[model samples]
Target chain A: MNLFIASLAFSVVTAATLSLAAVAFSLQFAVSNIFNLAFGAALTLSCYAAYFFFSIVGIEFWLAIGLAVLFSGLFAAGMSAFLVGPFIRRGASAFVLMIVTFSLGTIIDYGLDGGFRDNSFTLPFGGSSLAIHAGPFELSGAQLVVVALAVVMTAGLAALLHRTRLGIAIRAIVDNRMLAGASGVPTRKVTTVAWFVTGLVTGIAGLALAASTSTVNGAIGDNYLLLIIPAAMLGGLGSIWGAIAGSLVISLADNLWGVFVGTQYEVLIGLLVLMVVIMIRPGGLAGVISRGWGGT
Target chain B: MAYYISTLLVLFVSYAILGLGLNVQYGLGGVLNFGYYLFFAIGAYVGGITALGSDKGRVPALFQEIYAWNLPVHLPYPLTVLSAVVVAGVFSVGVGLIVLRSVRDDFGALMTFVVFLTMFTLIGAYANLFNGYIGISGVPSPVSNPELWYPILALGWLAISWLLVGAVTRSPYGRVLKSIRERPDAAAALGKNVRHYRLSVFILGNCMAALSGALLIGFIGAWSPLSWQEAETLVVFSIVIVGGRGNNLGVVLGAAVVGVGINEAVVFLPAVSSDPGLIPSVQWVLIGIITIGFLWVRPRGLLPERKAKWPWIDSKPGEVSEGNLLRKLRKGEARK
Candidate 1:
């Protein structure tokens, strides 16, 4: 019972961290129709930014987080505008976009390696995470913060999409770009903003994930990629709420598998669950857009 | 200097073989095979294990930490290489069974990446299965003399595989594979067995991949997980993409450029800044940029699959010309 509760506590923390990134990743696909394999690099890039500020410059943690988010968002927006935008303009398809993103990822990840020399760094909090004891389970201060942030972010995003004009425009762009463009939606500008916002969320997720893992490196994001994909796949490709639910299911499955089986098979178990889920649902948990093979 | 040049030539040839295999699978068949190194590893390990006389070479050193195996069986080199090719080919059949069901290109790539990583996890984590990361060593080479053997093997294997590739590409069988690659649904509508062709090409390409691995192991006299890095697949595939797809000579040319230019350029540089990563990181950054640049701007590659051919034949020039091209130049081939 105790072991089960501890695993549950841990999984909630994991789910909380993953939901932010998963939803952001789903959003990128939704608007741009890109797989954005480089999103992994964004995660690493933000994590390193946080590490640099928190560990090297020794700033307030929250301030460092803010800096990282702004930097990531700006970088992503700039990338979309300057680098990726031209190719798409030249009539690149999703498949070509996937490769393009892959290239960007390689450049960013390895470019950092050359600059930073491949050494692993940790987020330098002066002290450890505050311990909290409740019933049979124990948790950390950061863990609870993770849960709160996830709830707040999900709720905030839901409200934004539901209530705001910009959110409606973003959705319009996703559904039918031509129709949206015909209806006086600023499709290109809206897209840039959407990219910026998703980039910020991705950065936050990266920061949270780095904290959860307790180490940061260029390679760290690549491994996180395995986890992020299942989360995004579990949640439908484009739905925001679906991402949160998917994160919970995947994280819960991963922790339980660790408890019941061995940790070695944890990743495999998550993947298998995703495979089964995707096979049955096909549209994902709350699929807004149904995907067909070999289609635009 | 001779040794260095020979070693470089040998590696270039091996990578050329890899490029050729990828050219078939990706170029002609339209199957995205990102985890190609796994097949190479399968061939290397199978060949090494076959030629390796005793587990005695590994057990004492390996068991010092983890698991041990007791064995004694060494096959002849010819049989060993053949077994390697056959085993890897057969293994790919099993892989194709599952992967071909979904035609989503990115999904296929992702699944292969998963399989690639899983292979490492299994080999690295399980001490008993692959001796757990210490790797296998001291497999017997095919010939006693390195001088004659290497030069012959390098040129001989490249020529042989190039010829075989050429033959397959020019056949009517090859014609249908390209049709499937261009339009699977349309090709199927025309009564072509698209799935079967894809799988056959996949299996055939892997057979060549295995053969290369076998020869590579023979040259090095060792086999290990280290030899087949996942990135190696992408690098080799990038060569195919950079070389003109559907052209064997172009693939070999691309391999030589990347093999010597980007990969082996490290040999010349003075060690800078005591940081071992500086060179490799720069190299990867360059590779990533170059691949993307070519893919984005010049998708057809440096030497685009040539359309010009012998004036006598009036078929489309690029569809494997039959003006007595060696290997693929069989007389009486069906013309459109």
Candidate 2:
């Protein structure tokens, strides 16, 4: 029972961290119609930023996180405006855009590799564990915090998207760019905002992962790329709520698999799950339920 | 001077071979094979194990890491290379079976990347497999005497490989592959066996990749997991994209340019060596900028795939529709 509870705790924490990245990935795809392979690179870049600030400037944990988010947002916006925007303007199809983003990812990854000199740094945080019990579920304070943050972020994002003027405009742009443009939505500007916002979320996910693992490296982002794809796929591409649910299911499955089986085959298990999901439910879990995973 | 030239020649030839394989898949077949380095890695390991005779070591390797075997006295060096290609080709078939299901382009790329990392991790963690990171060393060189004859032999091998590639590209099968790239559903409607063609092309490309890997391992006289890193795959893709992906001659030329440029430039960039990070970072940045720039400026590449024409038979240049030329131009623009 304790082992089961512990696995659940682990799953929740993993799901929490993945939610931020997965949501951003889905959102970016929703608005821009580009599968940004460089998204992982952005996460890595920000993780490095946080590391640099904490180590070089001797900043506090919160300050480092803030700096990382800011830098990542700016970088994302800049990339969108300069690199991605021009290609979209050229009438590049989705397939070519995929390749373009891939090349961009290579550039960013290699750039960081050169800048950081293939070094690995640890996130400086050391604390004793605190445990808590909620009914039959025993959990750590860290796991609780993860759940809290996930809830808060998801709610915050939902409120922002549904309530805000920018959110409506973003939706409009996604639905029909021409109609949205005619109706006075600044599609380009909205895209830039979405990019920056997505970057901030990605940055948070990266930091969360760094904190969890206590290590940061350029390869760390690449490591998550595979995870992000499956999450988004399971959630249905461009579905925000679907991303959250997908992350939960995936994290739960992974944790349970770890408990039942060896960790060495964890990835293979995930891949197998994804394969089955793709074969049986191409629309994804929520996609099948709601049938909103079409058209795009 | 001769040694450096020979080294350069060997590197160029190997990369050229690798690039040609990519051109067939991505260029002709329109399959985005991002995890290309895995096959190359497999080839190197296979060739090394085959030549090394038996597993007397502590760790098991790929296939039969613990298998007891010996390279017979009668088996020639070329036969060993052929053996490597065949083994890697078999591995590729297995990989294709697993990943070749109906998948989106980017999804396929991601899956390929996953396979690459998983395989690497498996090899790295399992010390019994491919000796983990210590890597197999002291594999016998392809040429016993690295004198006048070695370069000639290597160049001759390269030429023969080129001829094979050229012959395949010119065949009706190659023409259909290109058509499949242009429009898969349309080709299927026209009675083309799209899946079979793609799988065959994929396996064929892997064979070429394996052959290149065998040659590289032989030249270096060593093989490691690091040698077939996923980055190597992207580097080859860049060469194919930049050199004109659909064009055979252009792919080789692109490899030559990138290989010769990066290899020779590293000699002058002392800071890259001193810092280690400086050179590689710059190389990646250059690759990115060049790729984007090529897509923006000339997607067709430096040497665009020229349309084969029979001037005397046609006798009409102006009357020929520009649709094919336009398609070529669009493809060239995609290089960016």
Candidate 3:
């Protein structure tokens, strides 16, 4: 009763943060069908960037988010162009590309580790303290902010995808790259922009994740990656809406398991959900996300 | 210096077992197993516990000793190693059933990778299972006089692993595995049970990997979660990819290159900084560079596996479709 409600309330806050990463992940896979394993590296890189801006540069918290997004987005775009895009353009298999992305991520991970020395640094952006009691549950100011951001961002993205010309161009590329190019879509430019925006969103998501979690480290991306991929897969990997919905479901299961089962087994919950979903629906929750639009 | 070189030799031999096993599966069978390290971890624990004898060992912990096992007569070293392999093999049967059904084509490797992550998380989090982060210590050693014994021990395991892999690869079974790797459809059309062949090969390879793990823990006289990481698998994968996949001689060459040349040789490098994290970070970065550089510049590895005599490699070479030529020309145009 009260416990159940409290669990649900807690899960909502987590779901909000999970959706931010999920949607960003969805967008990266959607265009050009790049199952970029470096999504983790991009996330970890942005988290470090946000930390540097706020703590080292003495920037304000809100402003740091914008800076993190800008820099990480640019880095991702360059990386995609130089590192990954060439492979995709060369027409590598989905599996090979996945390994390449992972290698890219590992490169970034070790570079960060060498730079940061494996210390899990804490961001002063958010502090653990008292929370406001809202009915049966308590929500921190940061938690409330995260929820609001998720809601607003979701609305904004929905509009961008469904209404804007850029979004349509991106989706058209996903639907058919050669056909879209033949049909005068400027497929290359649209794809580059899409990858950049994907990077931007991942950067923001990284910040949110760092603020919410206990510590930030070079390993943050790899650790966070384990959960994000499953969540993305749960909804079907490329569907933005499915990614959002799947995150909520995953968060719900995660919170419920934490409350009921031992906290140590939290990661197992996601694995269980992924396996079950995989069994029941191989095509993912939304539809077949197995390289949708990107031809085999 | 003699001791150091011997130690490196021991590690190289151990890693060779892991690489050789992987060669059989990925090289001959075409099964990509990213989570292969899990079997190695299982071997250490199972083999260590079996020989540990329960009378003298206690799991180390932060606050208190967790549990004590009933005193039983300890299994002999040879039997314990056999048991470790068996355990890892049995474990794979369960994994294969799920992974094969859910994952098709290249995705199976990623799915297995997920399993590795899950296994690591569980071992790390639950203190009761493997004593949490601190891990068990004083697991009992196999022989006395390390310098003399280790090389012998290492060589023994290496010989067994090598002979086993050589035997399997030269047999008709190996041919079937290679054929399966090339064309499951053609083999299935000829009445090969594709599912069964895949699982059996996977199980056998995992057993070899576990055997190597057992030997490693026995030599070190202890075991812990820190000793194994998913990244280690990446390094081995890089080895196979670098040394020539599926080629037994190639995997041995890869093991020597990676296990001794890179990983073990680093032990002697003078410390540039005492920052504690500097060395490990550099090592991993070097591995990443090696992996990526090889992937980009020379994907077939230094010693590419000799082309199989089967028609699989030659398929469609004589006939080039207009679409393929168009695609190639388009790629050229795009580059221009």
For every candidate, C-alpha RMSD to the true structure in Å:
5.2, 4.8, 5.7
For candidate 3 chain B, which ten residues in a row score worst on lDDT?
B56-65
Instruction: Calculate DockQ per candidate and list them.
Output: 0.50, 0.47, 0.45
True contacts kept of each: 0.47, 0.45, 0.48
TM-score of each: 0.89, 0.89, 0.89
lDDT of each: 0.77, 0.76, 0.77
Tell me the tens digit of each residue's lDDT in model 3 across B1-336.
877776777788788888888888788887878778889888887787677655543422322344243326568878888988998999999887777665455445667877887888888777766666666566656777767787788788889888988888878888888889878888989989887888888888899889888887776766777888767777777778788877888888988897778875566667766576777767877787787777778777778888645333233533666554555575695354
Over the stretch B81-126, how does candidate 2's per-residue lDDT look in tens digits? 8888898788878777656664455555556666776777667666
Model 1 chain B is weakest, by summed lDDT over 10 consecutive residues, at: B62-71
The reply for model 3, stretches above 4 Å from the true place, is A57-60, A127-132, A290-296, B57-71, B265-270, B310-336
TM-score (C-alpha) between model 3 and the true structure: 0.89
Itemize residue pairs with steric clashes in candidate 1.
Answer: none
lDDT of 3 at A136: 88
What's the CA error at residue B111 for candidate 2, in Å? 2.5
lDDT by residue (tens digit), candidate 1, A198-292 = 88888888888887777687777777777777788778778887888888888888888888887875557544754565456645788564555
Top DockQ prediction, candidate number: 1
Q: Looking at model 2, give its docking quality level.
A: acceptable
How do the candidates rank by DockQ, highest first? 1, 2, 3
